[model samples]
Target: MYTVSVMEDFIAQHYLTVPDPGPEGEVHSHHYEAELTLSGPELDEYDYLVDIETVEEVLAVVRARYEDALLNEQSKFAGHNPSVEHFAHVVWDLAADELDTDHLSTLTVTIWEDDDTWAAYEESV
Candidate 1:
């Protein structure tokens, strides 16, 4: 399958809600990098997996919403842990809502909370 990916970086604050969260229980900032990958067996009429510029535009909005914001305050994160895993799904949901998926086979959201730590969520379109 062909894959097209776009990435955006932003800083966001959040505190874990799980028990014995320790230092993580306190709000902190993560220099996050989120990458969205679109995959399909076939390309569109223009022979593109999707338009890169269009994806970048969508990611710009995504970055704007999360940059310098507190994750726990967002409706999508309400009662959620705000962990990287959950964050990945949250981003995936937002991107999916804004992007056309009829021609795509799968969408994967990978988020790096730090240089070495990351999580991902993937699903069929």
Candidate 2:
């Protein structure tokens, strides 16, 4: 299988509702780094798994949408905590809508909340 990945970073604020709760429920910010990966069994006619330009475009869109925003207020988070894991899935969902998934058979999103911690989500086509 062939795979291609794109990466981007943004800053956002969110709060967690579980674990210690309390002040953690208060909004905090993170310098978020997101990585999107797509994999397929074969390359497209252009000899690439997918267009790098398209991936960059999608990542840009995502960065613009979330950068400097309060993620907990977004409808996408709704009732769930805006944890790194949840953020990864949200990134995957956003990319899925913007990407041409016909050729790619797998999609994975990784979100890094800090230098030491990250989470990911994956889907099969």
lDDT (tens digit, per residue) of candidate 1 on 15-82: 99999999999999999999999999998889998999989998898899999999999999998999
Report the C-alpha lDDT of model 2 over 1-125, residue by residue, as the tens digit.
99898899999999998888888788999999999999999987779899999999999998999999999898899999998999999989999999999988899999989899999999996
Give all candidates' CA lDDT scores: 0.95, 0.92
TM per candidate comes to 0.97, 0.94
List the candidate 2 regions with Cα displacement exceeding 4 Å. none
Model 1: what TM-score?
A: 0.97
- The TM-score between candidate 2 and the true structure equals 0.94
State the lDDT at 49 in candidate 1.
87
Considering every candidate listed, which one attains the maximal TM-score?
A: 1
